[model samples]
Target chain A: MDQEVINSYIPLFKDAFLLTVKIGWLGIALAFLLGIVCAFILYFKIPVAKTVVRCYVELFRNTPLLVQLFFIYYGLPAVGISISAEVCGVVGLGLLGGSYMTESIRSGLEAIPVIQTESALSLGMTNGQLFKNVILPQAFTISVPGIVANVIFLLKETSVFSAISLMDLMFTAKDLIGLYYNTMESLFLLVIFYVIMLLPVSLAGTFIEKKVRFKMFGD
Target chain B: MEPVLKIEHLNKKFDDFTVLEDINLSIAKGEVVVIVGSSGCGKSTLLRCINGLEDINDGRVLLDGETVNPGSRNLTKSREKIGMVFQSYDLFPHKTILENAILAPMKVQKRSRKEAVEEAMQLLDRVGLASRKDSYPRQLSGGQKQRVAIVRALMMNPEVLLFDEVTAALDPEMVREVLDVILDLAKQKRTMLIVTHEMSFAKAIADRILFLDGGRIIEDSDPKEFFTSPKTERAERFLRTFEYEK
Candidate 1:
């Protein structure tokens, strides 16, 4: 029972944990914001941006998150656009998660009846006002559950960062396993980390979904 | 007399399908006009066009002597002077009934919140839903929602109100309640263009009844003459198919 080896991994574990949190949280926030903006643009079909968003969604969604991450991390350097691995991870996750976020939000937009928009228009709301005041508020509320779920999935998917040597949680765990060779202990801790991090998100999603459903349909 | 709403050869087409064609109508101020037709006869389309909700390719809708330009960038401002009630009520599910009623006045009319709420409460009272102001649309029945819809339309103090089959979605018993609200609105002398299938309701309150068939105004007459003796064969046939229960 070498508790010393496990304890030695603690500082590395702390650094890696913070990095994962940093990348995941930042990535999730940026992705959600971009997703909502791009989704609305796509939903409303706003000129060339609409087509660009469409291609962006298809490009990111159709490809693997890992490949997308690798391309941003490794491929971009060849194009003379080298960014920090941390930046690469964040941007990669943001773009990948944004693609899915756009789809989720697009579905929310579709779920809203055209009658609602027509009603808003009849009430004298400009298109921008209609989206800001009516459509976006309702759509965002409805899409909350889906967005949170996607965020959690994206957070878990951050494990793919080990491939990019970003020194995220999984990367630290692999390092520990290589040295201490305690696969069970290290893997178990990683699972615990995910569950702990994602529990609040899962609960928040359920709560938000219930509240929106209640607001929309009542108890 | 200058009609509050004037439609000259109005036509609406959805793709290759013509929904409303060559429709001509005029509604004077403070007049109640009821448009009646079977399903897909363009009655709703006509109402929507007047409110600037539908695009009409071939004609113009003038409100208060000014042509309602649907394609213009300022259509929202044009629509601000007009309010509409749908068969579905279309209340914002996220907002309380009070918020739903007050939103247009506060946002579009630029009325202060206190002023807006005061006006909205008055409208709620008119619709007999003052106590339900805090309630959401989901909490209200079909008839109550329709009544609220009527009140919501009036909140803007619109010169014209468009009701597109407001009671069609209600149950048999619920229809009368919504119609009663419309009847009450009619009493206030607000110009209203209503599209409905309720023959008796039309016969009772409408200053003029318009029978639409194949996107044309087949019969436009006073209610008494329309119910007693329709002018067109299409009107007679439509009346025969839908008998009013005495």
Candidate 2:
């Protein structure tokens, strides 16, 4: 509320912002890797793996990330899998984000017709080369919007990682609120910081989508 | 002379629906086989099975005296001898015409980029698309894309090329340009199996015509005999519709 108090919180907010970015980005990277793997598993319909990934996607996508984080941080220890809080938060967020990513990539793949593969196979491309060289690139370009949307959504989802005391922005804001009993100031700052950070990403998503859609569909 | 490609007792189905039933056919070295039939008669499915794009329920496809099995790891290697063009141009939208033409050569055959591009350029030139080589698939006209697709197939030096209604998606004026390219390739003695509804084009270029009805080869004979004197009632009726178009 006071000018001096607000000024003093700036340095602390900067560190918390960086921490949010660190965990957010790590979660995003893991999600991206898992997204491609899960998509391929379902795309090829690889035996038992497809069913397992299907279950994983259905489970993660349908359930709230809060419950997922809670299960990993608190519930998994009951099953004798004691993961650290940081790992729990990141992995839970990654898996949740990845579930959404799988759908995105799958939709991208399906947009390409069966004729494309037929054309590739006729040219003597092995399944591996077909997936890597032909299918993946086209899927990726078509997937740009979904990928970008998932990342931006995942960035906001990282805010919930604060529940596990991950020291992210929300957790840092809560700490400051507890210290000074200035909930309005800290909460307002939290919302402002998130909006400020996410605005560029949102804009970039639209710009990239337009450029790629134009290249692919000419509209 | 040995047949370059052979299809013996090929059968294909989609779930319970039988699309192709006990089909037997073959193409000799340098022969141009044109497949013409009403839609849903399995002409496209037959070519798809020959190139290993569709898994046949029961059949043997022999390419150059070797039995070709779609399930085998070497199937991809075997497909080097088979080229296929679809009704829709399936050129990689992201790459240039030159890149699309050279991709199979560089990736499958392990040819150097320089060597593949050099050969691709010559083929593109022959197809009259060398001037548009740097353009992407989306940039080209339907006929230009089809021409580039042909050049891409030629770059693989395929022993046989399959065209599945390649001009079906093109405009009437665009059809001749693409057909001229195929005609030139045929003159050079490229073994081709073309599935077309363009009765005139098929009659012009086909050495042999296979008229299919209800998933069976209703008539297989020279273009003059098949067109002028259809052997089956189904073939005769199918030809009647083409008369108005001509």
Q: Show where candidate 1 strays beyond 4 Å.
A: A1-8, B15-17, B244-246
lDDT of 1 by residue, A103-210 (tens): 999888878888889988898877877777788778877787788789889999899998988998899888879977888777766776777777988888888778
* Candidate with maximal DockQ: 1
Model 1 chain B poorest ten-residue lDDT run: B69-78
Against the true structure, what is model 2's DockQ? Answer: 0.69
Which candidate leads in lDDT? 2
* Per-model DockQ against the true two-chain complex: 0.73, 0.69
> Against the true structure, what is each candidate's TM-score?
0.94, 0.91
Span of 10 residues, lowest total lDDT, candidate 2 chain A = A210-219
Candidate 1, position B29, lDDT = 94
